[model samples]
Target: MAQHVERQRYWEAQQAARQAERLARKRARSIDWSAALRPVEPVPIRTETLIAALASGLIAALLLGDGVGPGLLIAAVPAVAAAYVAARAAGRRPRPWTLVWGVGSLALLVVPALRESAWPSTLAILAAIGLGALALFGSRTWPGVLLSPLGLLEAAPTGVRWAWQGVRARRTGNARNVWPVVKAAGVGIALLVVFGALFASADAAFADVLGGVVPDVSVSDGPVRVALFVLGVVVALAAARAAGAPLRWDRVTVAPGTPRSPVEWALPLVLLNLLFAGFIGVQLAVLFGGYGNVKERTGLLPAEYARQGFWQLLWATVLTLVVIALALRWAPRSGPRDRRLVRGVLGALCLLTLVVVASAVRRMDFYVHAFGLTRLRVSVVTMELWLGVVIVLIIAAGVFGARWLPRAVMASAGATVLALGLLSPDGMVAESNVGRYTEQGKIDLAYFQSLSADAVPALDRLPEPLRSCALRGINDDLADEGEVPWYGMSLGDRRAREILRERPVKASFETCAGLGTFRSRSEY
Candidate 1:
């Protein structure tokens, strides 16, 4: 018993010693102050970068402000200030961020100005720059960059120049690495090329599209317009440079996943480029020739506009989808199930829509033959209603039924194959024809005369060219067939009932309220 007790005591003492030693080691590790904090490396801010950022903003302001050159300066100040603040934090007394911000702001301003200069456009450019700056400064790797004066470096464009500079600087003990700069420059150049191609191609296409409408309107021969356009492009390029600074390369960096596949990373960009070119480049050319608003003046039917928009949208969608595919390539890896789940839901919804459409087709035959209902309008309405119902089903399926639907789709693939084969071709052709017809008949200025006063308000609220169209529709109808001829009246008289008359302008809110308070218009 004595021996056993002694042995037990020895084991207990050993355990206590072991525990004590562990604790001591842990304490020692905790108290090791040298390992607690990382050494702070100082970074110097470049003066040239600061100047560039501000200069960019200034140029943007000038371009956006139109002939009112001061607008550019006004717009550039905020960016300059931002740059300065950033530089101060980088242990440098320079203001490159401000300079770049100014430049970016200027670039943004110029593009809009070259298109159509206005306060709203200026505001939009400024807003974009501000948001971009916020995003750059808010990032995890460089939140301190925002606080640092050199944060503007984070805003530099990605390209050959940036890469070369980074390389040169790093080699000469001026920068850390040239890789980022190179990456930025390369991306920027790629995007520029893409955009340029889109612009050039779209511009050419516009010549064909606008051939029947405004054939005579030509580009301005004056150097001013050309200069403006050049300025706009330069500003855009500068802005692109600035914009390239904050890309999460880790997130967007491509990796070889599942080997090479049919879909590629460049596909999305291709789609995006095509869509942008089609919509914007085409539209610009059309506008330059003064036919951009022709649809409104031509009294184009609503169906026509919808059709035209459809073709454009279809191309746009294709482009967008391709671009999305490419973008997804660089996106962070996700589960296969998660990725496919969305498509599955969409397929289910489409199936549901097919069911609904089938039901409608059955009803149509009964209504047409048995009920002796043969009116074109009624037939059209019936078909539309059923189609609409199917569409709703598809949308619902996509939104809510995606997860399990894919599995079901695979299970019922055999049945679906037959139905889809039959339905796909006819439906696609009909839809396409309808789309084309609609575009061909799209509304323009001639129909403006037919709209009622009630419709005028909505039309007036539309963007410039379109609003003018709605107005024409309303006035034309009034002149030809309305009971009252209220032509030559100021804008206020048309809206007089809703507007108060206390202020000089009846539509002024203060005047309206004041007149209403006094009960003058109502009493009269």
Candidate 2:
């Protein structure tokens, strides 16, 4: 019986080992190790790429603007030019689509301008990001559109490899140039071994002279700067290469070409319509129910009553966009009446969403009036304005069967951003805040003090001691006239310096409390 039990245990152990071996074999089969062994082709450094690299570096060094006025407006020109040049390099004629790419580059250039305009950096950053994705992938259907620039991130390893190859080539070239010196040093080392020993043995003074000839360079921040320079070069080169050769549309596709069965779309959308209608009814009450009644009903503060609706409306707007996109992309071929019914429902939803947008804008206005102006408040107003435009476009598409709806929406958005870039954001903010202060006399001096040089001209419009004091404060802070290189020169800062130098703050420049926008938009 003991022998039989031992035999059973041995057989079980063997069975387990065999199972483990089989599992390992299965896992190995699942992987394509051929890719790991395959060599990735290097991105050849051509004349076009080299030119782009130089331009990118120069732009980075020069066109990087601060919270200076329309300095970004000026900086944006080169970026657009670069994109146009790059698009041309792709051996394509300057098509209208290439011009769209130019607009994207312009959008990037305006980020700083938008921030300097008076709204926060977040708005500008988001515009640049969205436009960047559009420029890269050329506004394909969903999922693929989202993956456009993110795909660049996925190629991080490839970028790193290209960068490494660049560095290696540079090092190899440098080594060739220094080879003679290295060879001479080897000979000198041999001579030193043959003669230095004799000289040191003959006289200790000769060894002392040799040691004195070698000067010790002290270690400091030099290495850190060198590392930063290297990092900048690598990053700029990578970005240049990518931008010059943007992702081809064919390479990134979304199959919105075919429609799904009508049955699959109809029921889901009908259910959505019921849900949205119920939500809209609530929104209607929120809009006209009066602030006090809503406050009492909800048991919230006046500010809370006002602040919460904008976000809800924003979500509704986004949801509407998603639904419309879904319907357009996947709804199957239907009879005329069914299609008409679907279109009618979608149109009603959009119209209702427009009402929601209006309510949101109203709530934001109430909140701002109650509290004060913030970047977020101002940015939301701008975004909602854009959302309203989108809804109008959607309605147009549905009503007129406009095939250009998507492109129009995108183009209009780009146009709006450029419009903002042209406007004085900082000046607008300052003007608004100053006007508010006049009405209520609630001034945040610290906030004003932190305002960029762009705000100086705006603050100049304020009356008396306030104007003089603010001007002096700004002048004193931006007092240091650092070495102004031709590159990295900020027009706004330069203007501030000039104004400070020219005016020197006389008591006479002060005026009455109320003043309209005194400077032209360009000057601000």
Model 1 lDDT tens row, 1-524: 99999999999999999999999997886555323311232233343443454445444433442233234444444444444443344443324543443344344433332221123234445444553453333322222222322333443333225434544666687444545766897899799767765665779775444432221213453355345444443433333333333233212112344532324433443454454445454434332233235355445533343334433333333343343334434533356754454354334434433433443343343332222222232334333443444345335544675333322322232222222222222223223323333455333333233323333433343343433433543343344432211212222223522321221111333432332322222100
In the range 1-524, model 2's lDDT, one tens digit per residue, is 99999999999999999999999986875443323222233344433444444444444433332133244445344434444444455443544654575566556555554333334344454566556555644544443345555644533345446546655775677666546655896898799777966886788798777544422223564454345334334444444334445544334334564666656667777777777678667756764576676676778765677777678777777887888877877756558876776687677777777877887887776676666665456566888889999999888877787656655776677667766654545656677778888899865444555456666766777776667655654665666545333233345556666766766665433341222112222210
lDDT of 2 at 101: 52
Which residue window of length 10 is worst by lDDT in model 2? Answer: 515-524
Weakest lDDT window of 10 consecutive positions for candidate 1? 515-524
Candidates in order, TM-scores: namely: 0.23, 0.62
| Candidate 2 segments exceeding 4 Å error | 1-45, 58-90, 107-126, 129-139, 151-240, 243-246, 249-305, 323-332, 399-409, 440-450, 468-491, 495-524
